[model samples]
Target: MSAAVTPRHARHTPGLLRSIYLPRTADALAFAMSTYGIPLLVLATTRSAALTGLAFALEWIPRLAAFGWAGSIVDRRGASVVFHLASLGRALVLAASAVLLRLHPSGTVASVTVMALAAITGVLTEFSYIAVETAGAAAGRRAGRRAHRVQAVLLGIDQTATLAGPTLAAVLLLAGLPPMLAAITVLSLLAALLALRTPPSPIAPARTPKGQTGVGLLTGWRTIRSLPALGWLVTGLTLSNLATGLLQAAGPVIVVKHFGQSTTDVGLVWSAAAGATLLSVTLCRFAIDRLGQWPVGAACAVIASLATLAAAQAPDYLSYLVLVAVLMAAEGGMTVVLRTLRSLVIPPEKFGSTLSATILILLLPFPVAGVLTALTPPDALGHVITACALLQGLGLALAFTRLRTDPALRT
Candidate 1:
């Protein structure tokens, strides 16, 4: 009987994974198309860099703001319900935006319409993101001790979608904005349909802890504060992201000016880096099984820091490209470790809220890096990168030291 049950369990696992991955893939592709295509549309319609910049800001601002409410919704509703609603909402938004664009082909009206579309879609996207993340967390829990493997596979899918999404969007845009919008709408509806097939989450809804009145951002904050090890990890990752952000924001400028490479070469550099990251994420699962999350995480942090420092001082484009690949590779490994630990540690009741809060904190550095890059002279960008890298190394050292002694590790 036990042997029969084992085979049945094995048969069910693939169906479960497939149901989750399919919707995730479609949703991610739609998001990627919108993220890339929208800004381009704005620029092409208005031909003003200022308005284009505002469009970009509009998109991200709503996305960040929506995380709070989105998480709350995910906690109140089930992941499947929230995911379906969000995906369908996104489809409606895109279709409506396309109609609006057709009415107002090009002008201030069109610009405002696009910006509004960006903001609305941004919010909807965040809702779906939180829903999927909650679903993933539930799946991770079901995987027991091999949770990292599940996360690794999901991470790989995301990276692959991110790499492919923009290029696919660019191709669709060649025909016209309407075609691109239609494609996104189709993908979103497909995602909604696929969401119905996913296994229902085994986790319960948000529960107010003792002494807490209700679940909210305050509760999430308290949850993080209650988990010292998780707090340290978040802080360390935040610092590391600053360095990585600086590198990313400065990539185009450095590749073109510092290295005398073409703009197309900039894409090549990042494509290669992303490939390395994909490989690293795949390898991290096996590494964690052998060396454990703690040692693997520590090694990744060290490698990322060292690579960042080397990339800053790299004398030529080829060397810089290699170092960037190495940096991203290590970052990928660290991401798997952090995500696996987050699934294991954060309470199911608080997972959605805490995940949103932590993600918001992590994203804060990217805009700051962009601002710093825009203000500084090209020649001095390398110095800033080096400084951030050093800070990353120090912060990670401190965080890991605390983590090594934390009671959570023993658990």
Candidate 2:
């Protein structure tokens, strides 16, 4: 766990996201887009918001445990083989569910079927995603910086769905259900085939039998505890991820209640955020290398917190869009910098596991925030999310200082 600070280590990873890892990821994104559609489906079938959130969170929850093992496996092996296989497998899972949904459009069978599919796909996507990213990120080596850019690119492609998927589902509601889901099924299969073609991750030095310790579960914990720099990096990232989750939890609450919009409106606004995230990531390649991790992360966090608060105050569409743009932009740079620092901080053998550990910590907050927001008033939730974001910004600001980096940067 080295804390070499900012602007020094190369953290580029390219095309890996779209090339092979994407097929399944795209499907997952497609499904995530369909989350907006779920409430409508539930409304049509049973009208249960609780069930809808349960299914949605169910889709999201598995990653917390599954990613840990998946990350360890990637570290022991190379990224390509595991990534491809996982994509292929999840495609099968979706296909099966699509068939079940098609067969029973209005019954408990359909509802249960869709929920199960969403949950399984959600777990697999993040599980594999953590590994691919761990292998990529760079500052200048192109591979280092490329990882986040690759993420950014996929995000751009998926934003179209964020922009379109919910509306498509909403429109399809008038016509019927079978045709719309059938279309999604076809797209999922296409992406799966693409994942099959993703090239072997061009990681340096390759792997040796010695590197396959198969001890990934405990590796990140051990490594971070041993290294001060890595510890600070993980702590900072963990806080950032937790805060992001809190913010995410508050978005839907605000959209549906405050704005007096339907589920489709919520999806549309998130799509706007996704679009901004895409742009932010694209611009980060040139800007991130020169700016480095600390300043980039700190600035983004601070701005995002303010933007979130502003989102609370935003009364109309224009203000909402602007606020969402700044908030999304704030998130994207940290995605790049965080991955870059993680790669630079850890040894190759422990890369996947350590990254997974960090991700798991980040992810764990998601369900907690979801439940918390469900219980609390939206205004309180907004305040809580903003405060959490501010704390993370302060953490990043601390990392921006030389103390966290002095040990690792000194070489």
Candidate 3:
């Protein structure tokens, strides 16, 4: 089941690119729909901020628990297979949820069932996401020296999906919850069909010696530990995610409470931020080519940290929106660089496991950020955000040094 290697000089064929991007874009759309729709539906039905928050948490917390094991499965069984299966499973879940919602529009049972379904979908989504990423990385490897360009294109596709998905969800929600769920179910099915079209990804042989074969869930963690530079990079990304988590947990409150913005205004601001992210990701390939990956990554980190800190002090809604846009742009560029580096460094066999482990680390602090947001006073939110930004800055500095010395990252 090992992947057949392509010649170095061969151009990245259109079919290959489509195989990688189409399914991923569909998955992103489905994800965005579920992420936005579930919370809005919960809030609209239950009229409780606490229940809405719970629904959101249910959609993410399971990812942490499933990451390691999912990665192991991707490695053993092949990413393409896992990707297709997960999408099919998500489609079924969404369809079932839609039917339930139609049957029982309002009740404690319906609400609990929705939350449970969201959690199950979350777990399946994580698996599909990891597998798709692994498959993309494998495709990039086949692109040879153009691998970074392929990565940038894929990242751009993802950013565009991010921009479109939420806006579509918002629009669809006005039509009502059942419509939204039905739309998501259709998207999930489309994603599954796209996955079926993807060519089989090259799989790496077992690392175990001949006549002995076994792999542990922690294999990904061990692989990261063995690579010092990757370890440092993941640590920096984890810190960056901590700052992002704080912003996510507190940004809405800051908008409504501090800026006195309406919910519509809040949505507009995020839409603007998403647009910025899309633009930045589209330009990432050129930036990496001109400046090198490490430098571009370091600059993005600095920019993100500064923008985040500055956002805490914005005097008006417009100023805050501008700062948030800048922050998201920088974060988007940084993510492309990090993902490119991950694809370049990790062995093909370990891609799924290592990436999942990385995501697990990234997600670890989000719950803590939510707790802090709940406990902190509105007046002190700025101080907390500034503190997180500073921590991110320090981690980025350390990561910059590590990258500069890393032989694998040298252009």
Candidate 4:
């Protein structure tokens, strides 16, 4: 007699294209909007680079802290519920700020408050990510594969938003600030509501030991330390993020100094870079079908490195943008693969917390790098890109060492 099939266990995998994924993706787009807007908005209203930088710095400060605690909560309480609460809070924070910004345009004090609230919302986003990530992992291998593919698509949409938000902020500036802020709030709320429909993720049938809740935090470190593949991947990723941070810190200056550019150029370049990620999305989708994560990810970084070198060498502004766009598109491929790998391997209940811990550990170098470059002369940004490329290349090499040696990594 044939074996009995469980109702939840379909013979073939279900399609991964949909998920309460849109709302989750939309929430990503919301922050893309907020981040893209922050620098520009600050510049337009306040005209102080230092103040804008301060606000940006202020927002990022809480994100690191939030990553640690929120992920743990997601593991213990619930991913979906946590997502909704945090997302709703994100909306309210922005909406309130919009109202205040409109009423008192000159109020730096109020702006700071709202900006900080926005920062809090930003913190909540990390947890929302945990929730979505948990849902993606709930379905097991085939389901997990599809889920991550969906994630690539989601991130593509998110990348598109990065371009769209800045463009929107620039265009909306003509209409004035209040309406724009209100629009951002509405968009965030819409995202939150959409996320509300996502069902709670199915927990693993295997029972974890008591006190495993707190274990999420330490366990991630222990896991990374213990697992050879995961450890190298995490280490490489952490180093790669640091290099990426340098690249990001140096990019605006590269445009401004390497080739004298207008203020408008910053937005234009950002749009170009984000637009490039669309191609990365395409490459990743193709790769997931033809190959696995590590190979494709390593290749992506290699391409980005060469592209960065090209950007460093470009004779003029137009040439630089073209190279930079190509480079970012390549980086996009790496990003997709990384996301897929992380989702496939991480445990469901602790998905958020583990990811949070991993990211917090990974992103530790970005702020320091930013400060380092800020203190450095802006004109020499291109030279720094070369240094960043070397660092990232080394990391990528280390991360992919196993895969390069053995064709099948996880399999």
| Candidate 2 stretches greater than 4 Å from native | 1-48, 134-180, 198-211, 226-230, 241-243, 252-265, 309-321, 378-386, 402-411
Model 3, 1-411: lDDT tens digits are 223322111112336646777888888888877877778878877778998889888888787788877877776666767888998999898888788878887898678768887798889988888888887787776765566777887788777777788778878879988788888888889888887775542333333221111243476788788888788888987888887888878878989999898878777777888889878887777887777778888888889989988987889999999998998899888787777777777776566777788777777888889898999999999999899989988998888787886865665
TM-score of each: 0.91, 0.75, 0.89, 0.84
Clash count list over all predictions: 0, 23, 1, 0
- State each model's CA lDDT, in order: 0.81, 0.60, 0.78, 0.65
- Total backbone collisions, model 3: 1
What's the C-alpha lDDT at position 241 in model 2? 62
Q: Higher lDDT: candidate 1 or 3?
A: 1
Clashing pairs in 3: 3-202
Per-model C-alpha RMSD: 4.8, 5.8, 3.7, 4.7
- Full ranking by TM-score: 1, 3, 4, 2
Clashes of 4: 0
Specify the highest-lDDT model's number. Answer: 1
Of the candidates numbered 2 and 3, which has the greater TM-score value? 3
TM-score (C-alpha, index-matched) for candidate 3:
0.89
Number of the top candidate by TM-score?
1
lDDT tens per residue, model 4, 103-160: 7777666667546754676686666666655555443345544644665776677687
Candidate 2, residue 343: Cα displacement in angstroms equals: 3.6
Pitting candidate 1 against candidate 4, the one with the higher lDDT is: 1
